[model samples]
Target chain A: MHISSTEVDYIALGASSDFRADGRHAFEFRDVIVESHLVPSVSGSSRAQVGGTDVLVYVKAELGPAQGKNGTEGVITFTAHYSSVTGLDNEVRTSNMLNAELEESLNRLFSEKQAANLERLCLLEGRVAWTLLVDVTVLKADGNVLDVASFAVRNALLSTLVPHVEVIRGEEGEADEIEVDDEPASRRLLLEGDPPVFISVCLLGSKWMLDASQDEEASMTSKLSVGVNSSGKVCGIVKAGEGALEWDGLGDTLKTAANMGVKIIEGLRKVQASRAETVGFFA
Target chain B: MGLREFDYGPLVSVERGTEVTTRERKRQWNELRPLFMRTRMVSHAAGSSYLEAENSKVICSVNGPLANTGGRTEAIERAKISCYISRTKFCGLEDDELEKRATTEYEGIVCRALESIVRVEQYPKSTIEVHVLVIEDDGSTLSAAITCACLALADAKIELRELMACCSVVNANGQLLLDPTLDEEKEASGSVLVSYLATSGKVSTVFQTGQLAYDEMAQAVELTISGAREIAVLVRNCLRQRESKDRGL
Candidate 1:
């Protein structure tokens, strides 16, 4: 993203005054609108329009045979596709590289010990289990895509329903055959664990901004995305873009992420609850 | 005897299993899925478009007429066209690994479809890149990608000799199906993807899987062209809307 001289100066002045180009505060985020059940074909899906950056997160659960040799818990898959919407889309290599980077950052956030509760998806101890696929699509990328995508994924999973399975023993002491419930109401709830939310902080000089827009993102020297759980614990850290940062300074920023992450989660929870007592996502 | 199985009647069409928007009546064989397209979504990219055809969603961005840094630019007469496709997985660290070969194969097809239409000689010693990403693959992905590539190219204001449009036809149970969904493609006896240069009315690219009788292929080709033309009008209108909007109309 190329910044003109005037734009650079505007950003620099904003940073000095702790104001942003879009008239946002140093630690403020743009308006984020999240809607779930955007893709009804999938098990669960949601779209998050964070300012100009729009990302759709979809969850699909599939059954697979046990893979731990003796069978273990199921797994969650994360994929982030940086579509051609970005300016670098013209460069085939750059587009591919950015898509890979997006996937890596998304995976790091979900690869933590409790990022997902896979054991609940296991139908049998060592025979059958469900593999949940989390797909993130960048429809419109205006910066801060990773954090926005993470929030969307968390929202999608909260409303996701896993199909109920009845395990029946085969005839005369044979293997167990799983039967999936046909009715939607019969499906069981998935994700009985805390969903991690990622917040990104852009460090420009002595000032840091939360949820930087594309222009601010371009001018920033460094970006750090920290994932926090409900317990205010740091689940993961993803250093995005190229920038310089002092170790001590960013640590305090991480603390900001922890505090704000909980607030963000609470905000999302409020949104979910307000919707819960009324119409659902599909409605 | 090993085991016995019972087959149920084919009552429900498979599109419902994917992303289907219910209406008073189902679309005809040659009719298209619900199409929503928007252009100029990206600031940095020269051209960009977002297209949603039913459940098949795609975003394509075009960049270039820029300098070719890669030594692979052996062509001096025409500008080089490069295509990149990024298919996301449903979940996990890795993305659509199984379709690695197929994705590259589609990239080649896209490049071939657009390379000729772009007046490469106009821009000397440069490269044009088209990047496409499939958000959801319900069906007719290649066709969606082709139309989007054209829209993005036009949005970028690239000098194009003509516009390209694409359609997917599948022959299943002796019936011609247009814009077959992923499930229909799986059940198809044969499938054909045709891209047409709408301005010249020329077939730019054709990819076929499975087999069809010669006459069936001929008839399918004609219907496929019709589908392409229908979509071409929509593509044209999308560009016109952008122009009108820019003029404050």
Candidate 2:
């Protein structure tokens, strides 16, 4: 759809009334359906869909030997690939641009101190650590995909179960030996800490809606993705798109983001509970 | 997702009577790898094509006839052609640095072959950007990329002096192999790459290295051109089908 000037006006007008073309409220989120442990070869994996957007998240943990001054810290790497299946509008150039932005945003969202606690992932303090490799693939395209991708990644990481490794030696003139436990269920990760959920709020005209669909994204100017954990603390906030936010409008947006983030986290937790009771569609 | 490895079967033994069966269809020793070609796969690119041969796949996208470079306009009377090939990390073969070098090498090969065929003189001071990503690399990756990029340019409807395609050959010991798989490639004594333009039947580019006898080199070159001829037919079919489909739509 070539968004003409009149359609832009109509979108703005609709947002002012807190109504979208899909009849969603200004802050109501699209239903997110997630299937975890789909890619069994990986440590953990999930395929998530929100509206038309679909993303596959895969998380693999590797034992990383300590390096440099930050030997005690673990690492997290985010790599995003866009399949040509991202619908009609995403050409290679646009896809590349979106890919670079997604990588940076995801890296910022999980690699920093405010986001995930890497220290917990460290195995031997300064000697060894578990480096989590998070790969997100866009299987489909819709607006608000970045937000949905973060959700899928969070779920995948939560379900990831690493092998319990025991380190012995470096004392009594013996070399160190790191051995992984044979038990499959050992070392379940406690992801409920600071690994937050991201909520993307799209600012159209007089309204900022949560989880904007592809149609809703056309006229929206600014998009603010806020990451918040269950403790109700803000972790990261990234503002993108061509739109800007005024000082007063920014605070109100943050407040809305914080409230919606909690709701999303709660919703995701309930899904996790149900998943434990039975094998998902993909086992 | 995790550590991914491809089974290359067994390497072609030099003592195996100069002929070995491939993993796919039971064809002659001179047979080409399986080819699947399609264009206009990318919605955003001016023209796009995806090519898969055996285990190797490359996606190519063309984005120009776009105006002038960032700055510094060299007074060339032809379109400034550039290529950037990225070997995606998830293929899970080599490390980051090695994969980066492989990408750069393929990008150079692709640029050279395409520059020879693209009608660059028609769009002076403009640029036609060709970007290729290797989804998988079994063997002959550069040849696959060059072939894929040329298909994309044709798909974009760029005026071309001649339509082009490519083929790779390897000389394993005394035996010559067409479209060698990764296992065959590793055990080969030398490799040859040849790109051809359909109209002229002329060699647009030929890349050869490693120790080889004069006759071996000549025979490999001939085999590559003939192999590329087969691939060129596939490219033509892809472009024709896409054109008819667009008109239908």
Reference-based lDDT, each prediction: 0.72, 0.72
What are the chain B TM-scores of all models? 0.85, 0.86
Q: List the residue pairs that clash in candidate 2.
A: A91-B44
Instruction: Give interface RMSD, every candidate, in order.
Output: 23.2, 24.6
Steric clash pairs (candidate 1)? A77-B91, A77-B92, A78-B91, A78-B92, A133-B90, A134-B91, A221-A243, B79-B120
Candidate 2: stretches off by over 4 Å: A88-94, A185-187, A190-192, A274-283, B1-249
How well is each residue in B1-249 modelled by candidate 2, as lDDT tens digits? 221132121122222243445533454557776678777668788888888776798889999989985545243577877788777776536684353243433454577678778877798889899988888878877888888888889878898877788888887767888888777777775677777777777665655544343345557778888888888887787777666665774
Tens-place lDDT digits, model 1, residues A1-283: 6666578677867787887768778777788898876776888788888888898889998998654334767867777776666443355324554666566556656644356655666778787888878898888888888888988988887767777788987898788798988776666557656677888888765688899888887777556666777767655444543232334234566677778888888887776655433244653
Per-prediction TM-score: 0.52, 0.52
| lDDT (tens digit, per residue) of candidate 2 on A1-61 | 2466688888888998887888888888878898898987888888889999999999998
True contacts kept of each: 0.00, 0.00
Error of 2 at B232 (Å): 59
Off by over 4 Å in 1: A68-70, A85-89, A92-94, A169-172, A274-283, B1-249
